[model samples]
Structures are given as C-alpha cells and as structure tokens.
Target chain A: MSNQILIPKLAIVGVGLIGGSLALALKAAGVVGEVVGIGRGLANLEKALELGVVDRITQDPAEGVADADLVLLATPVLTLTEMASRVLPHMKPGAVLTDGGSVKGSVARAIEPLVPEGVHFVPGHPIAGTEKSGAEAAFATLYHRRRCILTPTAQTDPEALRLVRRVWETAGCEVVEMDVEKHDRILGAISHLPHMVAYSLVNAVSSYDRYEENILEYSAGGFRDFTRIASSDPTMWRDIALTNRDALLEMIERFELSLAELKEDIRGEKKDRLYDFFLRSKQSRDAIL
Target chain B: MSNQILIPKLAIVGVGLIGGSLALALKAAGVVGEVVGIGRGLANLEKALELGVVDRITQDPAEGVADADLVLLATPVLTLTEMASRVLPHMKPGAVLTDGGSVKGSVARAIEPLVPEGVHFVPGHPIAGTEKSGAEAAFATLYHRRRCILTPTAQTDPEALRLVRRVWETAGCEVVEMDVEKHDRILGAISHLPHMVAYSLVNAVSSYDRYEENILEYSAGGFRDFTRIASSDPTMWRDIALTNRDALLEMIERFELSLAELKEDIRGEKKDRLYDFFLRSKQSRDAIL
Candidate 1:
C-alpha cells in the first residue's frame, strides 16, 4: 500500500446527476488528481464546470482520456455499450474503466470485448438516486450511506479492483462486490421490478374512465408514493426493463400471482384471509425498517 | 346561523388516532363544551383522558352519549354499523351523529335504519392519518390542511350536515360534500387499491427464497415507500378491501391490463413503447405534485 493517496486523473463520460455527483465527491475527497467531464452537448459540459464538479470539459473522448488514469462511464444503459467501445481506444494502457449502469450483465458483456489489453474493466451499479435528474440535481453527498455494488469479472486486476473499491468508499458508500449475473438478478427484484410495477400502476389509474382526475386529486394518501417511483427518467427505466427482461418478467409473474390471490379474497368477502395477509405484509415492512 | 358559536358537548367513540385527534382539535378550537371518549378497554380511555385528548372516559357507549349534543362514531368500519345502533337510543334528541369510517356506502346503509327520527346522521370520512396508531399518535394539528369528505344520504338533515361541516372546518379541514356511492368509489381508487397493491408487492417479494432479507436491506431506493404503505393496520385495510370489493376488483383488473401491456413491451424489446408509457406516467406524477 502506498503512504500517499493514489490520486487518479479521472474522465467522467456523460455528466448527468450521477456522473456530476461522482465528480464532485471525488474532488471534495481530494482522491482525483484532475476531473474532466465529457458529454454530447457543450452547454451541459459548461454547466458541469460552472458547478465546480469537474476541472475541465472536452468534446473529444480521446482528448478527454489523454492523461486520465480512470474512466467513469456514467451514461444511460442504452448508450453505455457504444460509449464504452468509442472510449476504449483512447483509454490509457493500464487505466481502469468502470460504468454506472443499473443493469450489469448486458453492459459487462458489451464492454468486455472492447477493452484493450492491460486495462482493467469493471461494471458497477450505485444503488442510489432521487426522483430528480440532470446536472442541477448533482450533489457531492448523493452516494453517502448508500450501497454501490461493483460487478467485476474474473479477468479484472486485483490492484485495479482495490482502487475502484477505495473510490466508492471515499464517497461514503458501502461497497458490495458480486458477480454480474447475481447483480442483475438482485436488482431486478429490488429496483427494476418496482419501477415497472409503479409505472403500470400510474398507467392503470390514468386509463380509468371517470376516476382518473379524482385519483390524481386525492393521491396524497398512498397513491402518491407509487407516483414518485413512476416519475423516474423514462429512457433510463425503459432501457433497464428491456435489458433485464427475463428477471423482470419473472418478478412480474410473482407479483401477478399475489395480486390474483388478493383479488379472490376480496371477491369472496374473506375478511380473515385479507387480515392475515395484511398482518404478514405489515410485519415484513416493519422488519425492513 | 347561531351566534353562540354552537359549542356542543361531544362524545367520541373508539378514541384512537382519528378519534383522539378530533377530540384534541375540538378542544383547541373551543368548539366543544366537553369531550368524552368511549372505548372497549379502560386503558385506552384512561390514556386518552390522560393525554388531554378527552375531558373524561367512559367504558359504556350509552353512558358516554347520554348528554352529548354531538356524537362521533370513530370505530373500525366493521364495528361502526353495529355500534351506531347501540348508541343511537342513548343519543340526545336534536343531536348530530357522524362517523369516521373509510367506506361510506356500507356504513351509511347499515346505520340508516338504526337512527332515531329526531336525531341527524351525517357520515364523514376524514382523509388524515399517520402510520402510527392509537391515542399516543394523536396530534392537535393532524387534520390541518387535510381534506375531510362528508357523505350524507338523502334522509340526512341539512341543519345537522351544516353543523358537521362547521365542526370539521373549525378543526382546519377542507370539507367536501359528496354522495355515499361516489365517496366509496373514489376512496377505493385512491386509498384501497393502493393499499392492496402495496401489500401484494411486499407479499410477492417475501415469497422469494431468503432474498427478501436482502431486498429489505436495499429498499431505501423505491421499495421502502411501498412497504410503509403496506405497514398500515391490517384489520382496517382488510375491512376496507372486503367492503369496497367492486371498485377494488375493477381497479385490480385495470392494473393487470396495464401490467400485461408493460410485460408485452418488455418481452418484445420495444423500448419506444415502454419509454412513452413511463414518460406519460411521470407527467401525471408531476401534475399531481
């Protein structure tokens, strides 16, 4: 172990809320030697710089990674594979590359082939975000007290993996390392399936004939909670659902089965059964809290 | 209009969160000459009095309503109808009696035959509560800025309805008057259906093989919100789902259709369709906020 902190010059691709927040955290912790932000739009890149998230901005991937020791791919899942390939040639020979994509299996497979020799590639998912998006929503403490799961393949370098773990730990995150397939499966149950259910719930109420307006008007009670989940970025969620299709579909089937059982109890006027289910479910929630 | 401020001696049955909170609000606003709490157990009644939520406590509903000018039936939905009959004979002539049951249609129908001719019956549902229950959870400002819907049948006296509205208004609730059927339907959509979904979602996740333990660990992202909703009183929610069966079943059917559409989009790998659905749902949530 080095006595001096390993301050890597980092390039953050797609400086949105997650990317920009990572840049800010890295700078705040003095773990990065220089932070450069790259994005498709110049205005977003300039805004990132103005917010002091990054030291510099570049439009060219090659130029952005010219002196970088670590590359953080923080784009949407749909763009991660393409962007990973585009930035591969520019990355330093021994530099470590990682991503912030929610779905890992597809992203890991897509980026694995594109990485050059001697460079380590790790896929990671930071399980934290608010309903808000964009660089304006970026904050240095966004990942604090949250879990960031790193899915490193068998080919990943031990030293490079240790450096990535140190980066997330400096941001005050609990780092959990897992295989890529397990990461996707667990996330589908906790994150991806919930998003799909919330979106469907909103669509269900909105499509009703006369109750649509009233539902929205009186949503403060319980419906509003689902709405907050449903209000996440559409493209991001769409990409997640499509990318993790099998696991999400399986969870949806489980949900439907439970829903059908509840509907039957309601129809049969089985108050005792409904009460038992509610009690068990409430106990589960308490256990979680 | 009475210039005397119409400070009625009030009786609140089943003085838990809703009933106890109402008693506090009535006393704070000086709208009640005396407030007496009636409960099945002596402990809750004594606790309500000790907490200053009620001026006195009574184990007998008949004894509690003997001299009261206004009586509030604040028991569970299943018990409210039977309890209404038991207390009506003891209620003073020219007194106004109302309830805080969530399902208005069943309660109104059940209580209609038991009401005496001289007394006025106005069924009301105060759409205010915390996850916490019992007298200890009661707060003076719980109903402030919250909506309280009154569902009065055609037989309900206009003067009695006016008095009930005035009481809730003094308690700082925006009062909305609607028919019993419409109130039940609307509440089924916003409150009942959401609770069912939350309970089912939790149950579905619990069915997974020990993965539920991990799901709870990482629930803060989105699933925790649903769990909180699921943690509501089991007896109360069970009665709600069973009583409001038609509307809940209808909502569930609509939800299943929407879920099927989402599943199809995921299965077909149609990102555009999924994105559009998420976008529309997000807009609805923003509109609600």
Candidate 2:
C-alpha cells in the first residue's frame, strides 16, 4: 500500500475499445505500471500509444506479455484461445491471464488447459461497450458503474482470482463471480438475443422489397435507437453467436414463438388480446429501465 | 403579415404528448392566439393548461371545437373517426380539421365523409414523438427539424392544406404532401413495424421462462435501448396495430422470413453468411444514420 504498483507490468492484447479503455482506466487509477498495447493492427497499437492509452506498443504476442504481471486478451471471442496459445508460452510463471469477451464458458473450457504450470486463467466479461470500435472509441470511464462477471473454475488460483477482481474494481466495475455456463445462458437471453433481433430487424426492413431505398428514412427515433446495436462489430458478434450457439439458438426459438403469438393477435384483430400483449411488454420493459 | 394570429383559436383533442407538443410549439411560435386542450383525462387537460401548452381545457368535443379556426385531432388512429364525427357539427364553417395520427389512409377513408359541408379535412402526421406520454412530456422543440406528412385527397380544400402546412412549418417541420396509402405503407415499414418488433422482443425476453426475474437485470445498454420502444403507450400502439393492420402484417411476415434466415445461418455456423448479413445491415443503417 505504501508505493508499490498493484500491477508492475500489464499487457493488453487486441488494444481496441475494450482493451484500450482498460489500460487507460488502470493507468488513471495509478494501479498499473508500464502498460503495453498489443494487436495485429500496428496502426491501432500506435494510436493507443499516441493517445497515452499505453506506455508501450507491440505487434508480437510474446514480446507484449513476456515478464508481465498480468496479461489480458481483449480480442473477439473466437480468437481468444489461439491468442492465448500464442502468448501463454512466453508469459511469466506467476503472471495472471484474463480476457474481456462477452462469451465465457467456451473461452474457459478452451483456454484453461493452455495455461502454463504456474500461470492462471480467469475468463471475464465486462458488461459494457458502445456500438463503436478502434482505440479512438476508448475512454477511461467506459467501465465505470458497469458489471463485470468473472467465471472461475476449480483450477483458478485464489490469488489470481483476487488480483483479477481488484483490477476490474479499480477500473470502477462491480465485479461478481459466477459459473461460466450460467453466465452464457443469461447473457445469451439478454445480450445475444437482442443483437440478433436488431440485426434481423434491420435486415428485414432493408430487404422488404416493397420500396427498399427510402423505407429506412421514414424511421422515427424509435427505429433509429432500436437498431443502434446492429452497428456493432460484425466479427465480434458473429463470434459470440458461434461460441454461445446453443444458448443463442434456444433464445431465438423462444423469441420466434412469442412473435408468432403476437402476430396472430394482430392478424385476428383481437383488440383486448393485443392491448394486453403490449401492456405486458410495456410493464416488463418499464420495470427494467 | 400583420399583427393578427395565424390561427385565432386552435382545438386539440386527446391532448397527450403529440398534441400538447404541437400546442406548445405553436404557442412558442406566437402563431396561435388561443389553444384548447380536450381529452377524457381531466388531469392531463389541467396539466396542459398549467404548463401553458393550452389556454383552455374542455372534455366536451362540441365545446372544444366550436368557433375554432383550426381543430387538430391528435388521438390514437382508431379513435380519430369517432372523434371527428363528435366534433364535426360544432366546428365553424371554413375551419380546418387535421390529425396527428400515424395511419392516414384508414383515417381519411372514414373521416372524410363525415366532414361537414363547409369544413375542410387534411390528414397530417408529424413524424416525431417520444415514449413518454401525457401533457407533462410536451416540449416546444419536439418537432424541430422533423418531418410532417399531410395526406390530402381530392376532397381536401386548398386553403386548408396551405394552413396545415404553415402550422407544421411554424412548428419547425419540413412539410411534405403524399398520398394517404403511400404514407401508411412507408410508416408501416418504418415506424409501426419497428414498434411491433420491439414489443414482441420484450415479450420474448420476459417469457423466456429460463431465468425470468434476473435475466433483464443482466441486460447491457444494447438490450435496454433496443427495447425502449416497447415502453410506449400500449393503447396507442394497439390502435396503431389495428388501424394499420394490412401493411403491418405484411411487414411482419417479411421480418419473420429475414429472421429465419439469420437463425439458420447461426445454427449452421455459416461464418461468411453471418458476416455478410451483419455487414449488409450495418452498411444499410450507417447509410441511413
């Protein structure tokens, strides 16, 4: 507590919004020293350095995470395991490794085995982000007041778990622990399903074939705001869809059943039923927001 | 251009967010000498008066529209015809009668016949509003830089059309004239369909039956913003669903088809197809926004 930094050398791979923001947040909290930004995109890594998001930048995975106290993989979910395999061999024995992907169970199952003898793997998801990408979208307050779920198994070391929790808490997140499977299911219902719906809805309007070009222009604020999530990174969401396929498929089926019932209510001109249907959704949404 | 007001007296039935906002905008523009708020809810009517959204309040349709230079029916789409019938007899000769309902073809078909010999009917829809309702949600800038579409048929008076266009322009709307059926079709594709999708999606998440109580709490900003439209007034949306039934049903069918394709793509892990699907929507949305 006297003058020692919590993380003497922290490595952040991927260095986009989530990774860059975490480095900025940890630096702002003064809990991390010698932050290193690593990514395939040299431009983004350089920008992160130029913007003071990191103390150094690197394109090589081994060069980035070697000798670091903590190495965080913040790439798209599907790439996390491969990136881990590349960097784990070179990381220090006691260094803690984690990620900020939306899907957790698959990541935990795939990467837990790749952890070196003395290294620790803690799969985490910071329940935050905008429909934005790149280092320019990064900000120190991106994770403030947001929830961060860490999925730790029996193999997770207690010290590594505490350190990971401290890192997120210092970045202003309310960190919670849960089993990885339950995290995927809950996130599948809330986050994955909604993104699918938005994506599908926008695609629907675009391909309506009635009057294609100008239909979206007539969209009011409701439509514009509703479809904002569809603008998120395609590769990231596609990976989430693939990684959490079972849970997402289940959620999609449930949603289709609900939509079918409401469609029938509208088609039959069941005024009372329609009113009750909308009233229930309104009440439910109102309770949430 | 003299010191005379554009509309000596204006009567707005169903004084909710839309009607109240119009009144406030016109009053702020100093174009209406007096505004009358009429609705079944006396509390909202009084709130409109207190907020200076209107100069007077009335429950009786006859007393509200009598001797007014302009009468605007801003109620739900389904109730516009019945309201028009109730107030048609009391409106002074040469007075303009318009509405702020979302659907226009059905309203025009039903209400145009009820217009008194000397009265003029112009069906207008200002493409603006928020999820909030009632007079308290009214604001003068609600319509600024928004679009207002007036569907005027052959029976519509030239003077009445001019006056309605002027009123919307004064409220900072870019007024456009279109056929009633085309307006309904365009709005059905954009506004009504999106509302229905949001309503159905919220219902879907609430009824998932997996982890009902805590699922929504885990929702990130994307899910919350995506479902915000579901919190709109149920009765108003119900009326919209019923009145714009055909076009909305068609749009729903198209949406279901689009969703089914995306669902299949996810289930099969068609990475290229999924990426392309999302890319298409993102490009379409980016173009619009």
Across A105-132, the per-residue lDDT of candidate 2 in tens digits comes to: 8899999888889888888999999999
lDDT per residue for candidate 1 within B114-204, as digits (tens), equals 9887988999999888777788889999889889999878898999999999988888899998888888877877778778888898888
Best by DockQ: 2
Q: What is the lDDT of residue A162 in candidate 2?
A: 97
* Model 2, TM vs. native: 0.98
What would the per-residue lDDT of candidate 2 be over residues B1-289, giving only the tens digit for each residue? 1234899999999888899999988888778898988899888888888888889999999998998999999888888999999999999999989999999988999998899899999999999999999999999999998999999999989989999999999999999898988899888888898899889889888877665455788777888899998999999999999999999999899889998999999999999999999999998888778
User: How high is the TM-score of chain B in model 1?
Assistant: 0.95
Clashing pairs for predicted structure model 2, backbone only: none
Candidate 1 local Cα displacement, residue B283, angstroms? 0.7
What TM-score would each prediction reach against the true structure? 0.96, 0.98
10 residues in a row with least lDDT, candidate 1 chain B: B1-10
TM-score of chain A of 2: 0.97
Runs with alpha carbons beyond 4 Å of true place in candidate 2: A1-4, B1-4
For every model in order, what is the iRMS?
Answer: 1.3, 0.8
DockQ of predicted candidate 2: 0.84
Model 2 alpha-carbon miss at residue A236, Å: 0.6
